[model samples]
Target: MSLVELIAQADERGLAAAGVSCLDRCVPLLGGDDEVLRPLWASLAEDGDGWGERVAKIRGHACDAATGAGAEAVSGPRSGPGAEAEAALLARRMLAAVPAERSAGALREWADTCSVAALDIHRLLDVADDGNTSVTDCREGRTEGMPPLVTAELRRQVTVLELLAGHGAAGVRQALEVSAEGRRVLQAVVSRRARGRT
Candidate 1:
C-alpha cells in the first residue's frame, strides 16, 4: 500500500485505532519502499505533474517517520487497545529510519544561520515562488522604493547565502545562488511592472 493510502485507512479507522495523534507517530507506516515505503512514492512520482510538491511531501513525511521510529519501533498493528505502546514504537522506527543527508542537516544549518536574521531559506523560497523581488513590498513589485523591512530582509538573505556559499552543502549553496538570481530577476520584473504601473 502507498503511504497516503495507509494514512487514509488509519484515519478512516480513527486515531484510537491508528494511534496517530501527531505527524511523528503517523508517518512511520506510510506506504513506500520495502521496509520504508519509499518505492511507492517513486511509482506515484512517475505521473510527474505534481512531482515537486509530491516529493516535498514525501521527503517531509520520511523525515517525520524517522523521528517516529526513533521514538519507538512498533512491531505489529496498534489499532484499539494496544495503541499507546504501538504509537511509541512506531515513532521510534520512524525517527530512526530517516537518513541524515535528506535535507535535515542543510535545513538545520540554513535555519540556524537565518534564525537571528529571521530570513529563513523557506522565506527565500516564498519569495522565489511568489515572483516577488521588491525591496519594499516584494510581491507587489515595489522595488525602487522599498521599505526598510524588505531591504533589510533582502540584504540579510544575500549575506547568508554568501556565507553558505562554501561549507559542505554545495547543493544548498547552489539553491541559495539560484534564489539570489531569482531576486535579481524579480528586481527586473518588478522594475518593469512598476514602470508600467507608474
Candidate 2:
C-alpha cells in the first residue's frame, strides 16, 4: 500500500510511531544526540502512559537545544549557509508542532505533516536535486528521480509504518532502529557539509 493509505488505516499507536520516527530521524538537524529521542521511543513501547509528559519534556529540551542552552546540544553544519539553516528550522518546527493529544485523528495529521517536513529537510540538505518541487507529491507516490537522501527517507518512513501496522507495539523497537540508522546518515551529511565549509 502507498504511505498515504498505510497512514490512513493506521491505529493511534501506528500514527504516533510514524510521526515520532520522522522526527527522530531528523534529530541531527535539531542538534540532538542519537539517543535524545529515546524517551519518546520508550513511551511507544509501553502503554500510553506519560506520553504527554515525555513529549513536553522533549519539546523543552529541543527548544533549549535549538537556542544552544541544552548541554546535550552539539553544534553542527545546521548553523551554516541558507539550506542548512532552513533545514534546521524545519526540523525544529517538527518537534515544536507535536500535539498534546494522542488521538488517532490528531496523530494522523501530525504524521502526515512530519512526513512532509522530513522530506523537505532531506531535499534541502541533499546534494542532488530530488527533481520534485512538492514533497506532497513524493508522499503521494510520484517519486521518480528522487535524490539519495530523500529516497532513503521515504523508504524509512514507509518501513516504520509497515512495521508498526504488522507488529503493533512490538514494532516500536524496530522502527526506532530504522530511525537511528537514518539519524546517523544525516549526521554524516551534516559533518561532510561542515567540513566542506571550512
Candidate 3:
C-alpha cells in the first residue's frame, strides 16, 4: 500500500512510530546526537507509557542544540546561513510539534506533518534537484528522477510504516535501526555541506 494509505490504516502505536521515525532521522539537522531520541523509541516499545515526558525531555535537548547553533542561524532567513539553518529550524519544529496526546487522530496528523517536514528537510539539504516542487507528490508515489537524498528518504518512510504495520510492537526496534541509518546519512550530508562552505 502507499504511504498515505498505510498511515491512514495505522494504529496509534504505528502512527507514533511513523512520526518519531521521521523526526529521529532528521535529528542531525537539529544538532542532536545519534542516540538523542532513543528514549522516545524505547517508550514506543512499552506501549507509549511515558511518551509525553520523553518528548518534553528531547525537546529540551533539541532547544539547547539549536540555541548553541546560534539564534541568528535559526531565527533569521537573510542572515546568510541559508538552507542548513532552515533545515535545522524545520527539524526543531518537528520535535516541538509532537503531539502530547498520542491518540490515533492526533498522531495521524503529527505523522503526516512529520513526513512532509522530513522530506522538506531532505530536499533543502540535497544538492541535486528533487524534480517535484513539493515533497507531497513524492510521498504519494509520484517519484520519478528524484534526487538521491529525497529518494532514499521516501524509501525510508515506506519501510518504516510497513515495518510497524506488519510487526506491530516488534517492529519498533527495527524501525529505530532504520532511522539510525538515515540519521548517519544526514549527518554526513550536513558535514559535507559545512565543509563546502569553508
Candidate 4:
C-alpha cells in the first residue's frame, strides 16, 4: 500500500490495520524540508493526483523498516511509485538529522501529540540504539517543567520542518530566520558528532 492508501485505510478500516493516533505522529516528521532532504522529499510529495494506494504502501513499508524487517514488510500492489516510501524515508532521514537535544521536545510537544494522527511514527522514533530516548528522554530529566533535550536548536528544527511541510501556521518563513539558541544547539550536535568520530 501507499501512505495515502494507508491513510484511507485508517479512515475506512479503523485501528485493525493502523490506528488513528498512529497517523497523527508522522505528520510533523514528514513536513521538514532541509536542503539535504528536500530533493528526496519532493519526489514523494508529488506522486501525482489520486495517489492513495501509493501512500499506503509507503506507510506499511516504513513501519516494516522501523521494525527491522527491511523493505519487505508490507507488500502488495506497487502503489504510486515510491512516494510513500520516499516520504517515510525522508521522515526518518530528517529525524536522524535532528540535533539530539531537541528530539525529545519536538516529539513531546508537537509531533507525538494526538493531533498529528500517527502514533507508530513515535513508536519507531522512540526506538534508539543510542539509548532509551523519545518518551523517557522527555520525561526523566525535565528542568523547571521543561525537557532537558528541548533546546532552541531542536525547537528551530521542528519549526522549520513543520512550516516547510505546511503543517503549522499560515506560513513557513517563521523557521528560516534561525535563532541564537538554535545555532548553539546545532553546533553542539556537530561538536558531539565530531568527537565521536575520533
Model-by-model lDDT, in order?
0.32, 0.84, 0.83, 0.31
TM-score to native of every candidate shown: 0.20, 0.91, 0.92, 0.27
By lDDT, the better pick of 2 and 3 is: 2
Best candidate according to TM-score: 3
Segments of candidate 1 deviating more than 4 angstroms:
1-142, 167-198
Candidate 1: Cα lDDT at 181: 45
lDDT of 4 by residue, 40-73 (tens): 2332234223324433544444444454312223
- Candidate 2 per-residue lDDT, tens place, 115-195, comes to 989998898888887335567777888877888899899999999999998999999989999998999899899889889
How close to the true structure is residue 61 of candidate 3, measured as C-alpha lDDT? 81
Measured on C-alpha atoms, candidate 4 has an lDDT of: 0.31
Q: What is the per-residue lDDT of model 1 for residues 35-85, given as tens digits with 9 covering 90 to 100?
A: 333332232223224434544555565666445332343343322223333
Question: Scored by Cα lDDT, where does model 2 land?
Answer: 0.84
Most lDDT-accurate candidate: 2
Instruction: Please state the error at residue 21 of candidate 4 in Å.
Output: 20
Over the full model, what C-alpha lDDT does candidate 1 score relative to the true structure? 0.32
Query: For candidate 2, what's the RMSD?
Result: 3.9
> For candidate 3, lDDT tens digit of each residue in 1-198?
667888898898889999999999988777657788888888888877878888888888878876756234544332235777788778878888998776899999999999999988888878886335468678788887777888899899999899988998899989999998998899898888788768
lDDT-superior candidate, 3 or 4:
3
